[model samples]
Target: MIPAIGWLLSSFLVAWLSARAAIAYAHRRGMLDRPGQRRSHSIPTPRGGGVGIVVASLLCLPGVLLGTAEPWPPRVLIGLLVALLLVALAGWWDDHRSLPILPRFGAQLLAVLLFAVASGVAGLSWWWLPVLVLGGAWSINLHNFMDGIDGLLAQQAMFVGTGLALLAWGGGQEALALAAGCLAAASLGFWCLNRSPARIFMGDVGSGSVGLLIFAFTVMLGRAGAWLLWPALILSSAFVVDASLTLLSRFWRGRRWYTAHREHLYQWLVRCGLTHAGGGVIYMTWNLLFAAPLAWLAWSHPRQALPTTMGAYLAAAALWLLLKRRCLRRRSNKDRHVAA
Candidate 1:
């Protein structure tokens, strides 16, 4: 318990210091995100602020592992570190140079595959091998897709990590929970520089690491039982719905389904005059008002999966309608938003 508070405070300090350092580094390196059409931010800001996130977490890694009974293997450490080095470098390259699509995706896939192999979580059977690869690839890609805004991915990651930590403590996974403690602390600290008009964008480095960490925790949680996946899925509902619907909508409109665009519901809200802070608050509120209940329901009645999933999906669809309509209405000069 004492370690919990210690981790939180220490991560906060680390994040604050790291953020300041990143901002200065970005300025000196001229790694700034210039404002433009389709961009919500109005001014050029320092990007790659996620470097701070990596620094803080890397610092906490040893602390979480020292003298632990269930120590992570050297292979796992090497795999994660090596994978991160590649992913972060690619992301840094993207932020600095608009990396071509195919190359970027190739790098992303290679990193995820190497990390999974390094962690020794290879497929269990011949049939499941392809499934495992596809799942890992899709999860990391979806994570990258969802990291389009300030505090969105990181905050959600923290929420899920904190919730998992709470469950681990209750379920006797003390080491895992302590690890989660470090992640939660690091996320909150990252938020200091991440909220509102941002000092730096996390770019790919922060978001990819976040996705990987959450993926790791989710796998650990799943080993308790498959039912546990529901709550974790619920906690991640916002990203799934936004990304999924955006892709589907684009497909429906005969647009390139995989190309970059600002048609996402959350992106529309920001474009429709909601400040970054306001948009983040709105998404966070929906997670609490809707997504959290789904998580609770999933945990409480793991076998009654259909109803719980329906409720969560319904909530997401309802929000999509409400937000999309509100933004379009604003564009059309409707006096106010209508509840769905």
Candidate 2:
């Protein structure tokens, strides 16, 4: 417990200072994002705020190695670290150079394979493999896609890390809990800078790293015998719904799935005249409303009932999306007319 607190404090300090420095560095380097068509922000904001994410995560590694997590086998940790490094490099490259989508997505695939192999994904039932792979792919891209607004990715990370840590505590994986605590703490500090009307943006590095970490954590927890998968999905349902639905919609319309666009649910909300803060609040609300009760049910019900609870959430998300999209279209038309 004390170790977790120590890590939390250190991670926050490092991430905060790093973000402040990145703003200046990007500004000096002429790396800011200027507003234009298909953009949300108005000013040329200094970007590449993922600097904090990389710095904070690297700082946490030493503590994880030095702490009680020692028994978790060095190779697995090293492999995971290598994957993160690859993603970080890819992210930085994307930030500076704007690498094509295929290459970036390729690196993410490699990371997913690395995590799967590292944690013995073979041990899981066959049914979960395709879902796990899809989930990993989903998690990575979803985070990147949802990074449109400031603080959204970091805020999502906070809730996710907190949820994983809770399940870790319940499942007696103390070391993992400590690691999650460090991440959650860093995310909070980063969120201060990332919040709407943000001082800095997360860029690709923060978003990719976040998705990678969450996916990895899920695998690790599943291996540790925690059956609380329902709650975990609930915690992340907002982003999942938006990204998946948007991608499917694009595919149905014969649009390329790999291209960047502004048709995401949150983007639609913004198009409908909701401020970024308003969208963030609504986005987070679903997580609390869905995850809280689902988490309780995950802990309370017998193992056999897990499927039923999870199914209910799937149905609910589907229904919510249908209604929400209709609402957005109506308001968005009005907004467009006003602008016209």
Candidate 3:
């Protein structure tokens, strides 16, 4: 317990101090995200603050090695580190200067491939490789898409990381627990400055890396016990439902779904006059009220995990549609009133 606490504190401090440095660096480099039609904040903010989280996450390796009685295979450890760095470096570069989509995506694909190969997922069967590649890439992109508002991604990262830590600890996976704990603690450190009226943005650097970490943790948990994926999925259902539904909606409407836009449900919340913090609270409320209980149920009753996961996502989808429609109507009404 003492060691775990120590690890968490160390991770928090690393992320906090690093994020502080990132703010200075961003200012020096002019890596500021200014307010615009597609943006949420009203003022210019420093971005690439996720460098702190990336640094903290990388520092988790020593703790993992020291904390776990059973160490990860050398190949797996090296593969994970390299993969994380690949994503972070790519994002960091993009934060400074936009990279073409093909190159950016190529980096993500290569990173995921390395992880799949080193984790032995590639050796399992022909089909597992594609699943891991596609799912890992999708996780990376979805997180990037969801990083629109201040503190939302950080808060979500903390929530999912803590939830995954508990699940890992319950399963006696000490290394995984430590990794997840570090992730949560690091996110909390960043969230201090990230929460509404933000001082800094996560930029591409942190969001895609976080997505990869979560995906990697889920893969580990699923390997521990396939049923464990249920709780993980339930924990992530909010972002999954929102991002997925929004993407499909855009694509179906013949819009360029791959392009950037402000169409997410959370974006709508801000458009409806909710503060970023308030929108964050709304998502957290769902996590606490809806996602948490369903995840607990899935964790406790492994046999019913599938049904629980399905039900949770179905409910989330319904809520997404309802709230999105409501937001649209509210915006329309406000527009009509202004025109009147």
Best of the candidates, TM-score: 3
Candidate ranking under TM-score, highest first, comes to 3, 2, 1
Candidate 3: pairs in clash? none
RMSD of 2: 2.6
lDDT of 1 by residue, 1-340 (tens): 6775676678768867887788888899898877777566778888777766677767776666443566555555556666666666777788777888788777767776666675455322344335545665566667777776777777877787787776666656676677777777777777778777676777777777676666666655655456776777777777778877888888899998666667887788887787777778887887888888778778778787557977798789888888898898886674333432
User: TM-score for all predictions?
Assistant: 0.87, 0.91, 0.97
lDDT by residue for model 3 (206-305), tens: 9999999999888877777777889998999999999999999998999998787889999999999998989999899999999999999999999999
> Relative to the true structure, how large is the alpha-carbon lDDT of every model?
0.72, 0.76, 0.90
Q: Point out the higher-scoring one by lDDT: 1 or 2.
A: 2
- Native-to-model Cα distance after best TM-score fit, residue 50 in candidate 3, in Å: 0.5
After superposing all C-alphas onto the true structure, candidate 1 shows an RMSD in angstroms of: 3.7
The reply for model 3, stretches above 4 Å from the true place, is 65-67, 121-126
Better of 2 and 3 by lDDT: 3
Best by lDDT: 3
lDDT of 3: 0.90
